[model samples]
Each structure stands twice: as C-alpha cells, then as structure tokens.
Target: MKAASKKTAGTIALNDRREICNVPEPSTTRLNKRMAELGMCSRREADDWIARGWVRVDGQVAPMGLQVAADARIDVDPKARGQQQEQVTILLNKPIGYVSGQAEDGYQPAVVLVEERNHWRGDASKTRFAPQQLRGLAPAGRLDIDSIGLLVLTQDGRIARQLIGEDSGMEKEYLVRVTYGDVAADVQSAFPRAQLMRLRHGLSLDNQPLKPAQVDWQNPEQLRFVLTEGKKRQIRRMCEQVGLKVVGLKRIRIGRVLLGNLPVGQWRYLAPQERF
Candidate 1:
C-alpha cells in the first residue's frame, strides 16, 4: 500500500491514515541532569538511584534516561536518603609528600592519613571511624604534594559537587612564604606595588585571564592569597610571573571551613553542623 503525504499546511503526515499538527518542542530535561541542577545529588548519583528504582517522577518510578518537565515533582526513596546520610566528608591536614588524589611516582595519596590512628584527638565530632568510610572516599580538591594544609576528602557526592564543581566559586585561602630576588628579609619593601596589583587582578595563566585574587603581604616574607579558582600549581606559577619565589605554601581555609589546630598528617570528620 502507498503511504499518504500531508498536502495541507501546518501538518505532518505520519502514514496513510495519520496527520499531526506542528507544535513547539516541549521544555524538558533529562532526569539525571534535572536532579543535579536541583542540587539533590550529582548526575551519577541520580542515575544510580533511578537504576535502583529509588527515584520517582510525577508519582511514577522514573526510568533511566527519562525526560522530565522542569516543573515535575521528583522524589527520592528513603533508602537513598539513608545512604546519603551515611556518607562522610573528611578534612585532612595534608603534609608535604602526599598527592591529593592517587598515589603516583612513589608518593602516597593524602587519604592514607584518614585511618583511625591518625584521627585528630581534638575533633569534636562524635562520629566513630570505620573501615567502610574509606570505600569511595576521595579527594574533593587538589593540593600540590609539596604544599601543606587543609585538604578535603569525601564520600559524599553533594559536598564534592559543591567544592569542586565546574561552576563552584569556593574561596581557598593560602599563606605563602616568598622571597624577592636576593632579598629574603624585608622583601615586601623591595617588591613593587604594581606587581602586587597584578597579582590581585591583572595576571593571566595558561593563556587565560585569572579571576581577581585577594593577595597582600601578611609579613615581610609571607603573602596571603584568597582565590576562587585553582589551576594546577596556580600559586607558585603566579608568584613566578611576578619574580617572587615561593619557599612554603599552606592552605588555611576553604570557604568558611578552617584548618585550625589540625596537626599535620592528621584527619578529622567534618562536624554535622559545619559546612564548607
């Protein structure tokens, strides 16, 4: 049989019997993406929940790759919420010689310090340490192996997304000990004000403009840097560009969280009421 074509305007012919009127595309998004955008969980987490029948859309169990309207009511199963609550976030005072993520070139990763023995005695959080907490635990951000101070490791996807996501604007504060040329003492007096200004706003790295930073002399040989972005070896490279040689670097803060009194190579659980 020959299929019929639509001869009329504003209509599309599907077959010999059916004709459909033209309509605007519906505003919808993938369920996983929508869940991530809503900050419920990461896209990967959403996919896992959907696969386990733990997610519902409009009161129906959501299928993988399902498209949902922007206004759709999405609910996560209580089991999924329970799992999320069990996930932990760890803060470590990553000493020099440990990589932020994976072990490489004979260097141990920072997470190795999260064992029970290394747990900080000063940690006020009552959460007990368990071997299961190590499973899926990973670094949320990178700190150079030679650098020291606050390094966040987590099993929670939401905290990871909040700290290192593509659109994240979390501030990382560093105290850098530097020397100006042959002047290690009173180097701030020799450093140019214009160079300091460049460090604050006008510098570029990797062929891209750096976002304005809060850079100021903390002492004669130390500079305090607060930056919103973390390019690889960013602080060292920025100092090099301005003729400053970094001898030491320590991160003191990330967002509102501080690395206060945490001994080197020690780890602590992020307190329940504490947030990054």
Candidate 2:
C-alpha cells in the first residue's frame, strides 16, 4: 500500500523491521496506518480516534488516511490513552466445540461463553464488565474447535498486535494427546528418535521449512509442543507425518500468562500488571 500525497489519503509500505517507509507514489495512505506504524495503537484504534478528531498531523486535524512524509510529526490527544486504558483483554479456558472467532456450521464462538456469570470465580483480577466490553471484542489467536485451553479475545489492538501480529515471536505451549497409528507399538514405543527429532527441527509444510519447535514427551500418551509460529492445524499435521494421530490437544500458556485454574467455558480479564 502506498502512502497518499500530503493532500490525500493512502496506505503505508512497511519494511522488514515493520518501520513505515515512504513510497515514491504520489497518493496518500490511511492515517490510521501511519498512527499504527508509530507504535501508538492498532489500525482499528487509530481509525476510532481519527473519527473523533483526536489525531493531529503538522498542527492540523488528521483526516482519514491523510498522506504525509514517513517521518511526519503526528500528535494524538491524551484522551486516546484514557480510552485505550479502558479496553480489556480476556483469557478464556475455551472448551471443545467452540470456535475461537465467528460461529461456523452451527457451532458457537468461544466469546459467547464470556458472560458475567461465566467469569471465573477464582480469577484474581478485579475488573468488572460492562455491556460495551463485548462490543468489538475479538480473538487474538485461534484455538481449534477440537481443542481445549487458553484462548485470548480482546478489545485492545495493542494486545492483539503483540500476540498475532505477522512478526510476533511470542511462544505458545500446548499439551497434546496422541496415539500411534501403527500396530507394532503402543503410544509410548512407536515413535522413533529420528522421527521425534524431525518434529523438533526437520520438517516443512506448504513447501516452507518450519521454525524449530520444542517437542517433547510429557507422558506415555501426551506430548508437549511449544511453537512460535502457527500454521493451520500445524501440530496435528506434524504428528501425522510421524505416523501419530492426535487424540486431544490443549494449550496451557502464551508468553508469560498461564491458563492457570480458569475452568473450561469460563473466562477472566488480563490483569493491568500482566504483560502478555
């Protein structure tokens, strides 16, 4: 996306480090994007503030996707920060049969389980809920309908960007229950050492090599998988390559936050002090 000219609106082209760079094109780009590139907030939040006339560039109120130099000065009213502070991030111990985002094929989204009554009683966070909290709340990362464990949904773009951004490096840990497909050995003995090593380092999906993953046996039937990148149905596919069938999967952690004691179908707020 090219940035708009000084008088128009356009898109931003981000470099390898995600720094916004000016393209040679004359048209201007989206102002929300420029704000996001500056590390202030997500594009969605930027648009909200821009609509409210909370952003200014070069001493003038910013218009939608206003074109400016890559290094242009942009100022946001302090009110934006206060609104961002009220945005919430929710942690759910999503149960099986719930989709992480929108509903599909008659199955419900995990967010529907986040009603006030469903708030975890053991949660230490004191944040209370309002009907508006559910508005625009979205899953930051996906949890498969067949899986159970920690799933994040947030109204804060900063948290969403940190967890699922294209360049995010946060680690996600899972406990997967698998079974041997071959008849020669039970779950414990069927997998060879070489195959396990491949699960850790030597595999590719869709012709692209996979990033190194931490794959280890947790018990006779369970494997612990810690990965930095998520491809569609990645773990199950990796196990299939090793002649193993996944029977169950559960995510336990994301970065420093743990699934903890949040019961299935229940959710809690990410504490103000929490980083992930």
Per-candidate TM-scores read 0.92, 0.86
Superposition-based RMSD of candidate 1 using all C-alpha atoms, in angstroms: 3.6
Model 1 clash pairs are none
User: Lowest lDDT 10-mer window, candidate 1?
Assistant: 1-10
Per-candidate local distance difference test = 0.93, 0.87
Residue 35 C-alpha lDDT in model 1: 93
lDDT of 2 by residue, 158-257 (tens): 7888899888999999999988865423566767889999999999999999999999989878899999998889999998988889989999999999
Query: What is the Å distance of residue 62 in model 1 from its true position?
Result: 0.9
In candidate 2, what residue range of length 10 has the lowest lDDT sum?
Answer: 7-16
Candidate 1 overall lDDT versus native: 0.93
lDDT of 1 at 71: 97
Writing each residue's lDDT as its tens digit, candidate 1 over 1-276 gives 123333442243333234245454578999999998889988888999999999999999999999999999999999999999999999999999999999999999999888999999999999999999999898999999999999999988888889999999999999999999899999899999999999999989999999999999999889999999999999999999999999999999999999999999999999999988
